[model samples]
Target: MKKYKDFVCVGFAFALSTVSCEAKNDAKIHVSQLGYTPNSDKKAMVVPDGKVDSFYLCDAASGKICYRGKLSPKKYWDLSGEDLQWADFSSYDKSGEYYLSVGGKKSYNFTISSKAYDDLTLWAHKTFYLWRCGIDCTEEFSNFHGQSYAHKAGHPDVNVIVHPSAESAGRKAGSTVKSPGGWYDAGDYGKYTVNSAIALESMLMSAEAFPSFYKNFDMEIPESTNNTVDVLDEAMYNLEWMLTLIDTVDGCVAHKVTTKRFVPMVLPAETNVQRYMIGKSTATNYGFAAIMAKASRLYKNNPDYPDFSEKAMRYAKRAYEWAEKNPGIIFHNPDSIGTGSYTARFPEQFRFWADVELYLATKDKKYIDLTAIDTFQYDVPTWQLPASFALMSLIVGVENNMVDGDLKKKTELHFDKLANLLYDRMEKDPGRFPLFKFEWGSNGGLANAGTILLLQYKKTGDKKYLKAAQDITTYMIGRNATGYCFVTGFGQKSPMFIHDRRSTGDGIAVPVPGLLAGGPTLDAIRDCDTYVYNYDHPKSEYPTREYPARAYNDEICSYSTNEVAINWSAPFLMLLAGINENSK
Candidate 1:
């Protein structure tokens, strides 16, 4: 038998199995394989083949019963079509390794400690460093991410062409521009401004929300010696690249820097394709302005980048001015281009975000006046639904007294309403997450939902909010309907074959660690139909998903279900960092 840390790897013949091999005794029992903090809401979901009522939490080594609890009443969840029972053990606060057993079946081992999420937080954050373009992921990183993870630099955008769609009077088609150093937007090698906006917001917000957690949390990237936290350094690498995408002549920002189409699955060094500065739109400017405004505030007065604050503020104002001039001009790829478009239906969200961020950064009443708060429906943050990011900033601004009484009251009420909605969803759902639709990139939604719960915890010091937030962490790690970790290389049954170009093309057995896969999409069959079956079981033998939560494929071709992305990763890192901070 092979061991994956605490989990035991077993054979391939389990019923309803997605992966060929998983944790030995985890067939009916699911948990956060990385375990929980002593005070966290430690609950395990059980889907037994037979009826079981009681559960025992026992010491892993000694086999002594530490806690005995009656299982919660069986609840049928339509998301997975399973009757799940929860083994509530939140009252047991001992710090030690333990496992749960019900009837005759047992779960994988887990630990109860203050540092349960430390490794996860570190691994998740370092993924940003590994995805960086224009710089070699040097062999020195092999010590941290293993030998197979290091690779030569790729996509030096020094000679990038300005596509006809993005052509300005001064910079026409085929004219060269120098734009470099940003993380790949997703499974593909593109770098998109709209997507990077939310991604960087999540990362910077992590640093802003929990300074003590990241103060000494070194990721050991190349910029570790810069006297700033490594998260800021990693974020700055992408920030610098984004700054280059702006048109100095007109102040409009390009939508993305991408090949005409997605390149084949190959390592970055192996690909030789012409990268172009794609079209620009109002969305790009607002997104860019929002990120720059937020960055200006975060990096202000720092010794390492003394002038960056002012520079960012100036560029932000420029972008905002251009956006005001060219309102509602949506971007579309030209006839020749076929990369990810990232088009938004509701562009006003971007304007709202820039207004809220600019207001928070400058404490100007004019910026706040620009936001249409009465009609604007606050949503969970995604690249498209970005008002949530601005809402979070407003909450922070109000708490810090950045605004006066009237605005603060409005911001507080907005947060309370949104947080209450999430709390209501948590109370009703068996999974304890605010997940309804299993859309593409659903994991990112879960992470953002978890952030809202955690922020509410910060606001009210409510243990219920903390418990609900921890449940989301557990669900992502393992305790979900899929019975997989959903991250690339963490749990015993995590994704080994993510639909990432570098990971699939590198000849490495393991995909890059810390990447959160686009988990459990409803479009799995349509996405994976043409791809090769790389798993041990035949396609026909795989379990039939009657519900959304069971819809996932670990094959490399399952882009909708198994691909990784920056927007997904950023919020997850924030969620983990926030959870770790509360644990400490």
Candidate 2:
């Protein structure tokens, strides 16, 4: 397994020359890589350090100024810790290739078209195949990363070994169990149940929210040839693996499957390392139940997969029962394990999600009564807290007249409050972005926030909520402090060295498309020591000021800033789906 210490020397080697002068100049004016929809409000970010007082939109080919505008009044951004201004181009509705010019510097070329995000939506869905595990990623399917025939030597995981890092009650070393097939969790090779559950829920919700959009959409995965909805087919590839985590004998589920240490950045086929099933916990079991219950409904009417719904419901019921019996169990990674902890201190949200989903699936009053629906707070769903999954399910139930009137009214009130709060916050923010806290995976947080706002737009028919959601997507592409598209292969100046093991080692010039990087971390808590020792050349090499949002670096060595994860990409897909649906 790889250690953090191994990268110290490598970090030092690249630190001095990583941030180029060109990037510094480009940071002055940041515009979206995908540009703006023809009729939507368009905006660009102008850093405080820049001297530009006004901006102009010029044709990319002709270099003729089409429109000019003054910068918005400066407002302090809590996340970026900087006073930033915006250049609004909302009135420019002509469809053309254009660039933003502030002072004498020209921003990256972008497009203003009706179908701005059409290709992006397809590419985002294809990203899942790139992150797939348990199979070879052939050149035919992968444009970058070439071909990696991985895990050929590995067995079916029919008898999972319990490593010392995962010792627990009813689980001993060399214990035989069946657990197999799932997508790799992140830049690493670990397969985490908590993260997988959230990603699956995102896909499921995307399907539920925009059935017509994803119904005939082609993901171009191996299962696309099958007579089934491509979105559900892609989700099933991961769901099948998640099913293996369930210990049918006892109804508990393993938290994750990983080696004892972080593996080196190598092709999956070359690693050939032994993997183990880690500790079992109520959180994992309940999350599994919630996702499976949702899956049961999604696949219930599918003619291609006849038994999928029944099997999912049976497993969900069993897992929910087990969680009820062991409600407080939390899996803390043993000291020996050096992978992601994915620990959840509170499992109530997980329980609530499972109950609501099960009720939706079975229409059982018992499940609804157990949900305690009114007490639960609605928020954007994350791996740690998944109350949004329950909220989403309930919203769907109310729409279908499956939920009680009193509970439906309460849920609607919560949605109204959240929607208004998010819209008001976005209106007040200098950049019109809806986030206040900039942490690891902050890009994902922004995307999830957009999902929440879009949900409210559906419930309330508010265009402001929809516009706020679109603003979050714009912020991600290039309208932020870093001035680079956080996704790997989209923008003119996008991430090239994201902290994905395969992308780093695959000998590919470009990383996979649509993989969202964990954006700026304000405190620099995880990678500060390495940065200080290696990149703090004369204290001026790195960005001098400690701005909350400006803390991002696009280097591969900066894992805190540029690591790509499934959880991040999932919500991004949701945001994309929302945009696509609304655009049409």
Candidate 3:
């Protein structure tokens, strides 16, 4: 055969353009509950033990009542008007769990599980529902995706997978951008890899997690059934096709899948640059393989869709092997994490939805430990860093089936402290905390907050988690923008923990500005209380594109499966499933 590898090397520029490794100093910031923030996690001052009168949350910083709600002396009491002593809601306890206020019954008695805020669980449910409803977010995204795409229970944003920018411009550019900068379907910004992989897995997860929906196609192939299977099918096709372009290139996804649109473009996989194809870019390809492996593991005897599991596993293994060898930038390692451009150490831990499937399929210890987060970091005498990876590490310990007993305890405590702190921030200022706090935005940020809270709830089974989830959902649904959330700023800096060490002493990571993805946020809020969204969020005066429109950031067009597939569509599908299942 004429050397196929020769064509790739000649056709593409097979080199990476990494950001200069000039030592970028990490930012020094103060957050309480990094276990022992000297000024942070101190207990709130209280009245004399014998006294019983006013019930309220007193903020130590301001020495004022942050919030006041009636309480009962009982472990779980009724919401009686006469009751006055209320337990203060704080992340100090646990998160992702919540309770409903039942009249004269249980105060904190209404328990929502830690998984109440789970991204995978809730979004999977929503995406399934959207699939059932027949108008997926991807269809809506096409309005911003530049080119139109067919939509039926879809991960609609799929068609534009490699497209650079889904341009939304002029005064119509609306929010999600700074000064309504020229919108390029190829050039706005976002977190591509992790979020997209999660979304991608959600597609398979719908089929696997709730076989009734995805696998149901085998039985009740409806006349108009174009579920995410189509989406994934196409994704696989495009993915395999894209491999042609990647043979020599170090790290980069094609500009777009459309034959015409991105025929001549490819860029380095920089943060906020090339379409967001983070760890999942490679991880997704592998994850798909893993999914197939899972299907194979399950369907080995079933002859119908026989090879899916096997093929999927093979693909996953190959991808993993490639990642180990290439080590392309992302959560592959911790040292490079704050370095930006996507990095997470030991993400295999905490049962990341993707890793979880593979672990479930193979029952591999290594994969489970992929979910393992390092508690050893806790022993290091340093500032408490609570990045997503750290959270994963904490989760690993809490869920540890294997590991030294002491390490497990230490891990659980670490998570406890983190959860407690997050809870406090949520209660204190659910709006401002978490930078990616529970709010309106296209970044699927609220979904992130919701998921994190749900993670906490699952861990501790504490009522505070339910409260956090409830509060976030309450705030979100109360705003009701027809499931669309908006914010300002896309191009300030990577939303991850590290701040820029810009040589110019003045220009730090400037915050850009606004739009929201309808899928993820709605799914997240729905996880807590579906009743919250009686009134939907309106279509923005400006277009849905340009969400979190940061001034200086570049856009990562189609590679962002988070915005397109998983976060956007999976939630709808999942929600639909929950609705139908319950209604049935």
Which model scores highest in TM-score?
Answer: 1
> How close is every model to the real structure, measured as TM-score?
0.93, 0.89, 0.40
Find the candidate with the highest lDDT and give its number. Answer: 1
Ranking of candidates on lDDT, top first: 1, 2, 3
- Please identify model 3 stretches exceeding 4 Å from their true place: 1-195, 201-305, 329-360, 366-372, 375-418, 430-443, 480-565, 568-584
Per-residue lDDT over 521-556 for candidate 3, one digit per residue giving the tens place of the 0 to 100 score: 222222222211111222112212322221111121
Query: What is candidate 3's CA lDDT for residue 100?
Result: 19
Root-mean-square deviation per candidate:
6.4, 9.7, 21.7
Q: Give the Cα error of residue 537 in candidate 3, in Å.
A: 19
Worst 10 residues of 2 by lDDT: 1-10
What lDDT score is found at residue 447 in candidate 1? 94
What C-alpha lDDT values do all the predictions have? 0.83, 0.75, 0.30
Q: By TM-score, highest first, what's the ranking? A: 1, 2, 3
Q: Please state the error at residue 163 of candidate 2 in Å.
A: 3.7
Error of 3 at 306 (Å): 3.8
Clashes found in each candidate (C-alpha, N, C closer than 3 A): 0, 2, 101
Model 1 alpha-carbon miss at residue 128, Å:
0.5
